[model samples]
Target: MPVTELTTDAEALTMTLIADVDAPVERLWRAFTDPRQLERFWGPPGWPATFTEFDFTVGGRARYHMTSPKGELSRGAWEFVRIDEPQSFEVLDTFVEADGTVFEGFPAMRMAYSFEPTETGSRLRNVTYFASHEALEQAVEMGAVEGSQLAMGQLDAVLHDLREYAQGKGTRTELLDDQHVRITRLIDGPQELVWRAHTEPALLEKWMLGPDGWRMSACEVDAVAGGRYRYAWEPLDPAAGTAFGFDGEVVLIEPIRRMVTTEHMTDTDYPSTLNDLSLYEEDGATLVTLLVEYPDRETRDAVLATGMTDGMEASYARLEGVLVSLPG
Candidate 1:
């Protein structure tokens, strides 16, 4: 299991974002500041955006409505607390009814947004705050996990347009798109065959669609937590891209059921995080769920959306194809 360790905050707001837009912080700022621009591309697709009033300034309020394709309307307002032109802004946010009535169950939230110019592109962070731990927990349980993911999906699309609009190289890590692509395929094969395809390099090489030229340079396994293993893959083509893939620890592994491993691109066996992948045999097929909980949402999503899921799905589909070819 391979995963990039991103940020997981202690405060429990669970608010995360990854915006790799074409424009520098300035352009991203303008897009955020310009109410018209914000309205042009806000909410998920097929969702219409309408504003009652938007004043981008300290002490000012941004009242707006979002109408979903399914005819659902969720309005909200944000009262600005801090303002740093083209750089940062803080506001209190919440949802409300069409008649300007805030919901009772959901509490008002504080959000601090930051924009920075990155050598690769631009990074925008939203530090959202809730009233209490319980509130955050409730939000998480009430579809926040799925909601945040869908929001990022919209951000991905918006930034794609912004990159082109601003004539910048959008955040694209291979054909995968973004980091969080879900690998969903019902693989019908024997437990032994499925296990071999994952652990054996010779079998894996034929299945894995790593970056072009990626070959399992070295493969080792202990299959348990507190155990260690190292894997190195060489790029079949040196000139095409960077070569040298290494992760030297096996933090957790459960034979035939699950495996959790720490992966690092560097060879230092450096400080890193963990990735858990579980497999269950259901209806004579393997149901595999890979959850790479990163320390932060930024880098985590970078790998999630990248054809990682697509790549995995394709590989597993091929693996199943190969399995069918095997003699019964």
Candidate 2:
């Protein structure tokens, strides 16, 4: 029944972070407000973000440009709370969990960022608020303290360069330049055997889909461009879970050489993804690449946001099984 009044100097540790940065005021402002710039220092090192719908203004939203191990880019929104230009700004950040459930308890923390003019450069402070003491303590136990420290360190490095670079900049820069999901695998067997298991309907059903509740209801291909391939994936428990899965569009088909197809994605009347499969040969092993492109970053994020490095490693293990199951 009561509205929580906004506050400054929200603390995440014993001592709140002092807003002291080695850059000028304008550069510090850019770091927080610019999605691409924030991305450079947002996540820990080597974690680059691919932002979408990045409008960092009041009542606007922004998403972190992040990709899961399986080439899925997880995205979240930043509801702008306030913006005070070169001095302070606030946002309520939201993130996705692994199990595809959305939980927002104590999540609407007030982020108060400040940039003060320092004799040398600028002083910056980012104070984060938790709804309660218990929330803060729980976050601390979850390594939030250490993670914030690492992120601040990266922010320092990015701001240091931004001040100098801003003086000679041309136009707005985009972070997502020349980015694509890359898939690579090696399938052992003769070129034809490998090709057969990939294009031929019968062999594909042997080891492709997991046996949980999946079956190849229909598998047909024209084996030529201007031609197409169709696969019917009927879930055993349609009443219990999602419905049928079908999608395979022939983009390119060269017998004994290569086949490129866009996997038609359908999940309970919702559009899914487009997977491109390419097969080649090198060093006596057939090289197969499965590149999946999603309709939007969110869909990709749904599958990958969980940091699927281990699962992906295991999926490749299953792919190895798929190759072994092929007829030699």
Candidate 3:
């Protein structure tokens, strides 16, 4: 097991677990900050986590659920209290209802995670501060200790395979669940440029065009929260296909880091989908992750059947070419 030490202080009302990870501090920190990596090990073996919303900023909140083997879901939420980049961060963790209401019966805790370099690789220190002695006892009874050990034990594999997740990988898609899908691409540019390419109409028009012989005829975007964006595409030849477009209202925006929107076909009765886009920069390249939540499994399958991934890949490849010509 990676966990080298586990201790609880009744007087302090805290539980601390220290694990020695065979990865650098930077990699370890990214595993925690990135929801895709975090979900891979946040839950025990049988209970896998799926983060529906992850806004990684101070005062931002994350909502996730762990699914049991029997298909039962245990919901949870985390309000980020403090963040120090690749060093340490703290959060207020609480059990919540599926709709995100806090469950008062369960114990809420202040959890702090710290990372430091070790001779082999790095060391992770996780401390959970309970509200009271009774609360700590309650959590222990709920298998909190064993559960944490198992969760951290699964982290090694994730760290070892980090490069395959985002580096040099072309646009890739992962079916997170029946309704949610994750698409990731590593853009050969900095986060600022990548964010600009996504939000700026002029930049978007240049590369957002999908397959060959298509052009972005109309591109209007208001990147602020509550703003609306419309994009239309037309084939160079009329024989290709009919012109189509999409419109969406931005639900949330966090500058260059994250954006969430509700998207829909311009004149279709189909239910709208939620698109959560996040950008993270490491070295000189930025990793763009888009978490799309469709209405249902049928809708998701239908969308994939339309060769959506291929179109996305074409656009992303074009985006990289555009970024290369921009002034750094």
lDDT per residue, candidate 2, 140-213, as tens digits? 67655554554565565356533242222312211221223434445555567777776777676765554455
Best-performing candidate as measured by lDDT: 3
How would you encode candidate 1's per-residue C-alpha lDDT over 9-79 as one tens digit per residue? 54665565555554577767776777765764455333335677988879999988865423457788989
**Between the candidate structures 2 and 3, which one is better when assessed by lDDT?**
3
Query: Mind sharing the TM-score for model 1?
Result: 0.46
Better of 1 and 2 by TM-score: 1
Instruction: List TM-score per model, in order.
Output: 0.46, 0.42, 0.61
Better of 1 and 3 by TM-score: 3
Residue 160 error, candidate 2, Å? 4.1
Whichever of 2 and 3 has more TM-score, that candidate is 3
The candidate scoring highest on TM-score is 3
**In model 3, which regions exceed 4 Å deviation?**
1-104, 108-165
Q: What's the CA error at residue 163 for candidate 1, in Å?
A: 11
**Model 3: per-residue lDDT, tens digit, 210-298?**
89999998899999878999999999999999999999898877688778888898888989898878776766788787878889999
